[model samples]
Target: MSYCVGVDIGGTNTAIGLLDGERVAAKESIPTLAGEGPDSLFDRIAATVRGLLGRCGVPGDAITVGMGVPGFIDQEGGVALNSTNLRWRDVPVVARMRERLGVPVAIDNDVRMYVYGEALLGAGRGVRHVLGVTVGTGLAAALVSDGRLFYGGGSMAGELGHIPLESIPYRCGCGLTGCLETVASATGIARQARDLVERDGRASVLREWFPGEGMPGLTARDVSRAYDEGDAVAIEVLRRTGEQLGRGLAYAVTMYSPDVVLVGGGAAAAGERLLAPVREAMQRLLISDYWERISVVPAALGDEAGVIGSALYGRDAAAR
Candidate 1:
């Protein structure tokens, strides 16, 4: 009956949950406010965990904490190697949590924790050789084989989004010009839609949201909704996005040969609107052997995947 805290810390918000075994006993969220530095950020997270623990009626020493974060990580060292979104480098995350929270802490790249979550309890439940893709603000994938998430040398494995594409000159936020994330992620989706709309592909409803040079307010949700209305431009945008995402999946499938590819994150809410194209493109891009066995399904745990996965990972890390 041991309890634990699972933390999913992102650029904008941090999700903290108290779990008893497989169920989330309590959950809460707080802004990361990354510009304030890691100490301040961790301080707020510590406070939030305290609040959740109080609600769960659990004591400090009775539970552990696990965090899923972005960027390169020192899993063994518990330091965030570098996270440009949070402006962090070598931040002593484990040491800080141990001092303030008084519990064992486990940490890894957010997507790794995500796939592990799926491998254990969600879409990939009871399955080995799993691949997970989070297709939201950014794109990332993780590989799990025989119940273990693989972190390649330097903990830099599964960075599928940065796989560059030919002829895409748009400079990615990561300083690359052809990364898959430049066209397949939620940001990429919006960027593509806006670019097309501004380029006179505006016979669609997107023009109401983005008149000439009005890209500031354009978002992927806006585009998806338009696609639901059968707008040709939005359909074209998602078509390209799914095609790119499928291409990325094709490579991962060939390399890892996963049994399932769980597509998670916010944009996944598009469901078949997004995945059908991904499937279609993956079929075209992958070899017949890779295509027939792969099961590309949506992530089942939804928002709680991070929370539950981190908590369970924390519990296991503590035992080790």
Candidate 2:
């Protein structure tokens, strides 16, 4: 049987998987330590993929490779323009990979890859149109229509996180202020929790989680745990978070009117804690005619979404 390889590079971890169709033939994950820069990071990925292929007894000619990276990617050109998380600027990722892996390679924005996995194997299966939203350290979205990902003129079509939030006025890594990213990302939620502590000194489980340590140490998981324990402050933080994300999804719903909207990524781990409010807020923001027509569901593939999607992406590239 033929096989393909998929790699999902995140701020902290890089996941690699070998697939024989939908069955994962082998998998591995390693630290990206992205701060070390792209060359070092790519070196790690190449080594890991080489090992995985060897372990699976797969040849380079029998496998295509696909990769998902954050930030603006010139997928067709095989270049990564600007990946804020990786601190990358105009890097030739695909060309570099071809030099190392000796196989056909395809690349796309991480979130789009996640959504493609969803469209093919998870929540969006059989759906003709899909809107995929990912809430992790950052927020982003991708649109898939008639079973294909959409890239607008600039390959920046789904930058929902950069749009300004009315009340927030903080600078984002993207060099913008008051972005919806400030209120909706995992980092954004932690930032809000920190602001609440500074502004009101209000008592909540978050105070216990942080103590005198201050804001930088706070995390979205900590907030989720605090919320689970019925901390009013954590509850408020997530409520605001879900609502903001819901509004973003609402706008997407109104415009794309997709068959389904799939929510994924780390923050989505909060499950009902995040999705409930998102659904409620989306319903509140959308007109009655549109609210019931659109479906919003959690992404089912979790960490594997990007991997599977990437492999599938590569397979598609080879076909073309």
Candidate 3:
């Protein structure tokens, strides 16, 4: 039977899955080691794919590969134009992978793949218009309108993370000051928590984890754990982060008027802790008619959304 291979490449790891129709037949992950550059990374990825196919007793010729890469992508040319996370610049990803795997390859931005997966099989199932936002190491979003991925003129339509917020003083990796992701993403949340602990010298459980002077290894997960323990600082951190995220999303809602806004990614795992404020802030900013018509919820597919979406999209691309 023909199969599709989906690859979700992130800064820290790459997740790969084998899709047998609508169900994931097999899946695995590998350290991205992105610092070693795309060539080394793709080499490992290709090896992993071969191993998976061998173990699954599938022939190489029977599969088409799809990849969801973070950062800017030239989907038509299969080139990773620029990826701050992966530190890639104008890398011809399709040529490299196709040369190694000898299969048809398709690629797109990772968040777009994620939303596509949700739209087809997860929270967005049967929904006509879906807006998916991911809050993780960084933040991003994608839109599916009428069951189709909407790539605006530049294929950069849903880049909500980079929207500048005047109140946010932090500098973003994109070399911008006060981008929304600098405050609303996982990195943002941890930064905020650390700052609060350091600036105000608040007695927070977070201090236990980040006692030392320089930037601590504190993470959003750490903040979540602290929030669970009823740490005042952690609670305040999530509330502010969610409020910023919600305010950022309000702009998307006003423009897209989606039926639902699906939030996903690592920080989203906080569930209601983060979502409650997101809902509140978004509702407060939007008019009653728009706010009442839209629903904000967590993305149902968890980490598998990107892989599933990329694989299915590759399957379609291969057929075409």
Top lDDT prediction, candidate number = 3
lDDT of each: 0.87, 0.87, 0.91
* Model 3 lDDT per residue over 135-244, tens place: 98889999999877888887878889999988899998889999999999898998899888988788898788777884478899999999999999999999999898
What residue pairs clash in candidate 3, if any at all? Answer: none
- Residue 203 lDDT in candidate 2: 80
Which 10-residue window of candidate 3 scores lowest in summed lDDT?
208-217
CA lDDT, candidate 2, residue 313: 88
lDDT of 2 by residue, 140-200 (tens): 8999898788999978798888888777778987688888888898898888888887677
| CA shift of 22, model 3, Å | 1.7
lDDT pick, better of 1 and 3: 3
Instruction: Report the error of model 3 at residue 287, Å.
Output: 1.6
Cα RMSD to the true fold for all candidates:
1.5, 1.7, 1.8
